[model samples]
Target: MEQYDIAVIGAGPAGLFCAIHSIGPGIHVLLLEKNLQPGMKLRISGTGQCNITHDGDIRMFFPRYGAHGQFLRPALMSYTNQMLIRFFEERNLPMEITEGGKVFPVSHKAGDVCEVLIRECQHPGVDLRCGEPVHRVENTPLGFVLYTAGDTFSAKNLVIATGGASYPKTGSTGDGYRLAASLGHTITGIGPALTPLLIRNFPFADLAGMSFAGLPFSVWRENRKIFDGQGDILFTHTGLSGPGILDRSRDIRAGDEIQLSFAGPVQCDTFEREFQNIISRAPTRSIKTIIAGLGIPERLARQLPDLAGIPADSTGAHLTAAGRTILIGHLTACPLVVSSPGDLSVAMVTRGGVALGEVNVKTMESKLVPGLFFSGEVLDIDGDTGGFNLQAAFSTGFLAAQGISKRVGKRT
Candidate 1:
């Protein structure tokens, strides 16, 4: 059986980074990948542009990961976004920050990012093998042992960077959860994050391609408001999408109500007053015409009156008080009930994984099992879109490498 100083599973961003950083004199590292090639999902990130990391102060990145933000503070602060940019730029790959502060390679090719990591893996002391799926792992007093279909390997330290169950075609099929569970680690409730929502009886099927920037929206469960924020929203044939919807998808569940405000941040009462004033001033004008004047898209404005059960030819003067209230409700708080979120196949990230309580945030090492570590999406850490997830993967991987290196030094 072959032996290694450290063995890292899954050759996505996390595994590759851990292996690359773990290389040192006499410290042999084995990087195992189930797929035929490495970085399969990384190559498709950001629609192939590869938003590597967000350009901003590292302090602002905490809230992007939702409730798990503080847990990632040590890793993120250790490997800041500027340090990540410099790591690539030093290797001759320049980066650029486009609109919305998303950082990407100058060439705008995700393959470029993968190529750099692949080349780095070619260094001595790092053995990268593709198409080798680890079926099981066992802990030994001496170290850890990994089993494949035809091979077995031993390592003094192990890092499970197998990622979470998202984009399964790239080899992320929740295998890490199983492996972690076998090792006595708790796997939290797993579900799709950063996915689109399917609305029940969607009304805007005809306006599928329409999108809004910084659209204000709120989520409600029963009568209680659970979430209220704004982001770019896209109207799909089945429901809603875009950054605004995807970022908050983790917090939403089936049957939750999504209330969209087409008229910015105007409240119900404010909008009702403004609507009444508009109607009083333009009694001769059509309701749809008056709605379009309030900055709503003409097509959507035209359909709003019909959705509110108002006649097409009705003028503001013909709109009764009740009819006015209905129109205001539609404009201010158009409610759409979620039927379901996009499944794991469509989700960009997984919400849950090995519970964070079982792992050390400062070093990415397992608290229950010494010399065992985890990183990336497999460790109950998923961030919002626009490079936050990728950054977390790299930061955690780097921290895991540091932890493994220190333990190996102590053993030697």
Candidate 2:
């Protein structure tokens, strides 16, 4: 058997980073990838541009990872967004930040990001073997033994950096969950995150390409409001998409109610008062014209009156009190029922993985088993869109590498 000081499974961002940073004298690192190529998903991030990280203070990143943000503090603090940018910059890959604070390479190519990572793993101490998928793993007093189709390998330390179940074509097939479960780790309820919602009887089908910025919205389940936030919302042919819907998709489910405000962030009472003032000021103006003047898209404004059961040509002069109330309701809190959300096949990230309680947050090591660590989406940590997820992956990988290096040093 080929013995290694450390063996990392999956060559995604996490695995590749762990291997790269684990390089040291007398430290043999084995990086095994199932696919023929490495960084398949990384090559396609940000629709090929690869949003590498978010541009901000590291402290601002906590809430981006949802409920488990606090758990990633140590890892993120150890290797911050600034450090990540510097790592690539030192390698001659300059990064640029978007207007919305998303960081990407100056070349605007995700391939460049992958190229740098793959090149870094080419050190003499690292052995990157692609197309060598491990069938199973066994833990022994000596350490961990991996069984592959062609041969078996043993390592003093093992890191499972296999990604989540999103984008199966990129080789993220929830294999890590199975591997972790086999090792007596708890796996949480896994589902799709950062995916679009499919609305039931969607009304804005004709305005599929329309988008709203900073549109305030609320989620309600069985008449109880569960969440309230705002983001950019896009009208899709089937339902809704864009950062607003995708970021909150994890909290949404089938049959939940999504209340949207086309009139920005105004309260119901405030919006009604302002709208009534508009009617008093322009009693003869068409209702559609008044709505369009409120900064709503003309296309959507034209449909609102019809949806409110008022004539498309009705003006404030002829509008009834009941009609005004319905129109104001639609403008303020238009409720849309979610029939379903995009499935795992189209989801950008997986919401759950190995339970956080079983792992050491400071070291990314398995608390139940020594010499075993985890990183990336394989852990039950999923961040919002932009560069948060990738940053988390890289941060965890760096921490795991540090942990493994210290352990290996102690043994040596």
Candidate 3:
């Protein structure tokens, strides 16, 4: 029957960071977790590099959340990239900038960052728990009571830092969603984001183990343009993936066509001109060999002829003028039928959760209930790849903890 000023329902980025914000000399905060360790998912993020944050201006950070990004301005501003970097530096975990402004610890270990956060909870006011599964959250006359199999705890304020439903092995088992909804908060449609795309084409098999750079691709939702970006893309056994494809995976619906403008920044006419003139430089070469050098992956080079309704073996000398134009068009505009996105289990993050409007945007507290706050992937906001998800989790958790600090400290 331990009593505390604040009870946090997770030990991940949101819960732990939130506890850090609120925990001072007098504050008593309990951070709970079901896993044996905190930040198991963080340990594996960015292929184990753990992209800490982006190294860009604020506006560049916003669009990472897609449409819901607008809601994250306050928290992100309150704890910007510079602050995050400084926070790590203060703790002796210096960071460095990777490609696309993505930040990572100079040591390149996600566990090192997690270690600093875990060590931060060593302060007297913070009591962090692991391997504890909280069963229910009940509002008590005093404030809130959280029941776990091991013990029952009461708090003046509750922060649901329980994360999203991606990477179940990482321990985000949609616990926050259930907890928030139980307290009368409305959760939006939840789906996988920043995950890989699943295409049905078998020829895609040939492209497996291939990665491309500087290729542009477009995402569409029933004829309406959703997003487009030029970057590296890779083909896995499951489907198309990489930075450009994962960014689009959030809003992509079922049965959508993933139209790829392989020409990238080069306009269609310019590509067309480049295509026609390219063969002249290698007039004696096979058409497949000539187009293979058109700045695309070698696998795509051989496939373009088949896609253009011309035999791949056909040389530039064998093709008619119409064939040349058709080949150029197919090369510029390669279409991949995106039957579905990669499995949610394999997804990097979740798309939707507790609605932002239902929670106080300023405090991250539940509007329907006092002494209740939510953070991390449980929130409705979703960001694309490149460390935005972790940043969101860290921001909301810290913000909610600040609110709890003010309320609980005054009550005492």
Model number with the top TM-score: 1
Tell me how far the alpha carbon of residue 182 in candidate 3 is from the true structure, in angstroms, after superposition. Answer: 0.3
Q: List where candidate 3 sits over 4 angstroms from the true fold.
A: 266-285, 320-326, 409-412
Cα lDDT tens digits, model 1, 184-268, are 9999999999999999999999999999999999999998999897999999999999999999999999999999999889889
Residue-level lDDT of model 3, residues 1-412, one tens digit each, is: 8999888998888888998888777778888889988878888988888997888886678888888888888888878888998999999999999767889999999889899999999898888889988899888688888889879999888999888888988888898889888888998998988888888664567678788786777766677776776777887876788887787788777687776666566677888777667676667678777776656666677887887888877777678888887776676656667778776698898888998898888888888999899888989878877888888888888788777776766666
Colliding residue pairs in candidate 3: none
What TM-score would you give candidate 1 relative to the actual structure?
A: 0.99
**Candidate 2 C-alpha lDDT tens digits along 240-316:** 99998999998899999999999888888898889999999999999999999999999899999999999867889
Task: State which candidate has the highest lDDT.
Answer: 2
Q: All candidates' lDDT scores?
A: 0.93, 0.94, 0.83
Return the TM-score for each candidate structure: 0.99, 0.98, 0.92
Query: Candidate 2, clashing residue pairs?
Result: none
The per-residue C-alpha lDDT of model 1 at residue 202 equals 97
TM-score of 2: 0.98
TM-score comparison, 2 vs 3, better candidate: 2
Error of 2 at 172 (Å): 0.6
Please say which candidate is ahead in lDDT: 1 or 2.
2
